[model samples]
Target: MSEQSRGVTVTPQDDRYPGLVEGYNHRFTGRPEAVRLAATTQDVVDAVQDALDTGRRIAVRSGGHCFEDFTASPDIQVLIDLSPLAAVSYDERMAAFAVGGGTRLDHLYQELHDGWGVTVPAGTCFEVGVGGHICGGGYGHLSRRDGLVVDHLYAVEVVTVDDTGRARPVIATREPDDPHHDLWWAHTGGGGGNFGVVTRFWLRSAGPRPTAPEHALPRAPRRIRRADVVWSWDTLDEQSFTALLRAYTDWHEKNSAPDSPGRHIWSNLIVLHRSAGSFILNSVVDDDVPGAAELMAEQLAVLTGPGGAAPAHVEEQVVSWMDTWMPSYSWPSDPRGRYKNKAGYLRAGFTDHQLAAVHRHLTDPGYDNPMACLVLTGFGGQVNAVAPDATAVPQRDSILKASYSAGAWTAPEEDELHIAWVRRFYQDVYAETGGVPEPGDVNDGSYISYPDVDLADPVRNTSGTGWPVLYYKDNYPRLQRVKKRYDPRNVFRHALSVALPS
Candidate 1:
């Protein structure tokens, strides 16, 4: 191991090599020649320069929460770890909040809220790093009210490789006339590892620059009202289950308009397999909103209507926003467990046929994993107000996002079983679209934040539509142009990264 002002470089012979080779997901482990622990932006630049000079493959990792093997590929010769660069502060020069790309969501949220009483609409997973999250159009509980994280993104400081193979930092903003504006646009939702390494992000709401710190971003809610309702599998027959799902979907579809009263409400329905014993519906809303309690009760009533089964248990609480956000509500990462996740953007509620398929898969006796589940997350509202082409995220009109996932296994032998089950389940649900969610009236495609390699596989995604179309929709071409301009040598790429124009 060699230590320098830039950072520490751990070679294969170093003791740190073993720990740095693996990430959050235990499924993939890399055998890189060296690991560069970048402590500053200059460290990143030097690391990239070294890779370019040595003709070695390189990859970057922030919080190491990547779902796939993008950074953990075996072919990677040098891994640049940015976790050491974590920092969050307001940048008066840029009139925006400057967040280190390596900063975790939990750290970002606490700093923004405690320091300025503001926050961004990002993902619920607090461990997620801002580097990839913001670039992939991050969204969560506040999305329906404020819009996606990228919607408020002001500028990004990325280290790009020029045509001459020289690595340098470039600052790109949302300003239309800015020469590097396309670079900023591509990061909005084009996903990470496609353009270059993002060292810092400047965040401020769209519109005139705010003179005061408090006025720069959306105000953090004073308090939040949360409810978790669960229904036992025994009480849910096919009819009741289908009715419950339909009720939740219909309510969101009707109330997800930009100006709707229900915009303050955010919910997620986790439909676990029968082996899990019960399915759960978790909802939250700003307690400061008028009739917040009443709205919550009404939504519960709709889901547990006469036609559907009554909830077996319900838990409700009101807590300060800081209390709710801190300590990270996301499930702790299990180092031994492997995970697989597939996602799609829903333009509307699932049809009767789709609902039936969901029920069949959840109750299938052949599949007994309690960890297998499908999740429907509330979306739209202010998000849909943006034009599809306004940002790299083109599925702005989607009402809900569906995720099919399976995990909780420790043995590598169990990978095939769990993966096959989810693949079959997702395929069956979208059987009409050639085993995948193709951009259409009901399905707007998938979320890049929840990247799935299956979408790029011809045998799995028989939809004929390529992965680029499924994720970027009509924005793929523009992203490619941006890719060609910034990464002329394709220095940054991965399994599902943007392809150069033919």
Candidate 2:
């Protein structure tokens, strides 16, 4: 390839090229001219500069867990891999935890919990990189009590391209008086690959600055109570299924308050297609909470009581937080790599009519994919305590987050069949809104973390709302301004990236 930088550069002829070209989703791959393995901030700066100097389109990859082809598109000529920059430590100078942008969630949890009894409320997918997750306003089990990852963000070190096309590292913090304060706000939930390559992020709880590392972030839970409740397809009819979903959502609507007792409880209802044999509801709560067991039991009773169909199986346990937070912790695996994901935020529970659509699609006899499923995860609580304009993530009143996904296929020919199933399933659920979730009283719009390009496609998204409005709401204009100031050349961009201010 061209002259190499300080970091290692692999070209198409390199033996490692094949592996680097692909990402978590096997659906997309790139044949870039070169893949630069950046191990430090300077390395990323040099790599980005090289790409700009050569007039080659570039993209950055960390844990390779992106659901879309943003980084692996064929148009990318230079792929900058940041996995080597993974590092986690307390920054004495900033009085915050300094996490490498490339660090995985699992690694970050381990380092934070082991070194200091603290952790950020990040996503549960251990393999996800912090680079995109934090910027996209990630949330997880602790989110109900702790808020989103971005809510605790103190500062970020991003390598940005100036108007002169020179790449340099800049540090932006939450301090309003700071010159680059807006840059920090944009990264809060602006999504990744929009402004520039993030080299590092410093996290600290919002409030008075803590003098010690251990007190810098939210304290990690000592133990957690978990329950797995499953119901077989044979046990569920259309009425029962609808009741079950309604009951789950209704509970969240009532309990998703900043000071609600149920804020400590986090649950996910995984509704699989009939071909999967059964669906599951996984719930967790901090065992240290008073009456934790009783709270979980009561929640379970509400769900089963409505349907009158007892769960086919129920398992409960109490385990150390490390047992669940460690990188070794594993969940059910999908052998098939290719997948499609779409998500939306719900301000209230699904109506009866919407529930019927969900039941009809999951039980459709024409589609037999076992991996196809709908997941509704608990959201809000502390996440809603923040003002809508305080961060780029403006959906502050959502109670539940719903994700529609389809996977488990090895052949490319099955792409159309699997993709169409999920698209139709999502469309029918929001049929009242022109085939996509539009901002309204019930649906607040979609999540940027689970980026769905289909929202940008006119053929798929019959809704008049554009993708920018769906993901950012009124915050899009602010993000566009940040894009103009930091990346005037638009050096960092992808399919769903913020467009320049017109």
Candidate 3:
């Protein structure tokens, strides 16, 4: 067998492979005994097939954004890094964009928006890879107006290893009647890298199309309202916190729909900065400036100031919605910046007491990180109106898809504490929202893209919710079937990957 690097290889590990490294994720890097940077579909297939034949564990990296170390873990000896396999092009016949799985989300945006004038309902972060990004039912600013990323996904090219340890690449389309129809469903939101190593994706036909003006995509929105409201941990008491949660919840329930005149031209970045030890409420809405700014000012005023305009970052923008969103957080239009992330979906908002609990957690300041922010993104509109069975992501009807994370910390020691804080916060705030999987009144089903390996571990995510069930919901079964069909030997097993049922 070919052996390279410091680790021993049971199978023939190509010592010449240059991509092998020690650390890989945005948060933690992974060192692999051998790393193969595949340039073609054949390479991906061979990597999978080799891992199966040699009884070696394998992990795939596209944008290195897997919240956990699933793809970037050191325990993973053989790594297949696909970030270099990226290539995007337009298909005249399909009228949809053919995007490589390795391509970054923002790169696709630049191609579709700047080159084509079209845009996909994708993640806000430009660096996120389209590979695993869309597979987890990706959502972005456009989600409220359009839908999640899967809503616009038309097809995918994937490589999976069967029980015989033979890797086969399959091209699955969203035809609904195709032989591999179930495979497409599994890819929609089943979580990437588990069922197969997807090489390319076909955007939906009826969805956004690239044009020259925007690049062939939908023209950027003309005017937008960028706003923010901050509350000190000391100021937001239990009653006020509850009122804030209720206010947001009520606003969403009262005005959610693609065609609603009161459509939210908004995004709330609920932040907890350990350094400052304060919570900043940031928002940006796409509504009639004069009308919405006033109406919204009132709705929020009840919970915030006595009256007057919103404080800090408060203003209505008349430029393109695309540009307006860029400066909301000084998040430049660049994807090269590396990031560490964790996300959660609120089936509902927090209760009054729960808000107070969160305030308390933020104030205690257990971890010190600059890029720390608990972003609360309101989700619900055309995306949620669809049924869970309809796509790979089932948390469609979520009232708020919140993202809890502490971005960059130079020291490895801080990772455990920050991550621990998010998980614990999720647990403490869960009871207020009822939590997930059950029908009664639950709202805490985590996002697969923002994977928390802790959820899969009995000791970490003691919430009793399993990985597949929490991430895929009822769709977990189909994902398992696909896993068995492609990766039967379980070569891709990771902390949070979908497993073939015993």
Candidate 2: tens digits of C-alpha lDDT, residues 1-502 = 1224326998999888887788777898888999998888999999999999999999998778888998999899999988777889989999999998889888999899989989898888787889999989989989999999999999999999999999999999999998999999999999999999999999999999898999999999899888889999998888888878888998898889988899999999999999999998989898999999998988988887754457899888888888753332344234348889999999998866688899999999999998899999999999999998899999999999999999767798999999999999999999888778899989999999899999999988888999999999999999999999999999898999999999
Better of 1 and 2 by TM-score: 1
Task: Identify the candidate with maximal TM-score.
Answer: 1
lDDT of 1 by residue, 1-502 (tens): 1335238788989877888887778898899998888888898999999999999998988778788999998899999988777789999998999998889988999899999999998887877888889889999989999999999999999999988999999999999998999999999999989999999999999989899989999999988898889999998889888988889888988889998888889999999999999989889899999999998988888887774569999888898777753353576678777999999989998977789899999999998988889999999999988999999999988889999988767789989999999999999998999888998888989988788999999899898999999999999999999988999999999999999899
Model 2, residue pairs in steric clash? none
* Alpha carbon lDDT at 446, candidate 3: 74
- For model 3, the local distance difference test gives 0.65
Question: Which stretches of model 2 miss by more than 4 angstroms?
Answer: 1-6, 324-336
lDDT of 2 at 433: 87
How much lDDT does each candidate structure score?
0.89, 0.89, 0.65
User: How close is every model to the real structure, measured as TM-score?
Assistant: 0.97, 0.97, 0.83
- For all candidates, what are the clash counts? 0, 0, 37
Worst 10 residues of 2 by lDDT: 325-334
Off by over 4 Å in 1: 1-6, 325-328
The alpha-carbon lDDT assigned to residue 13 of candidate 3 equals: 47
Off by over 4 Å in 3: 1-27, 53-55, 205-219, 230-242, 273-278, 286-313, 321-324, 327-343, 365-372, 431-440, 460-463
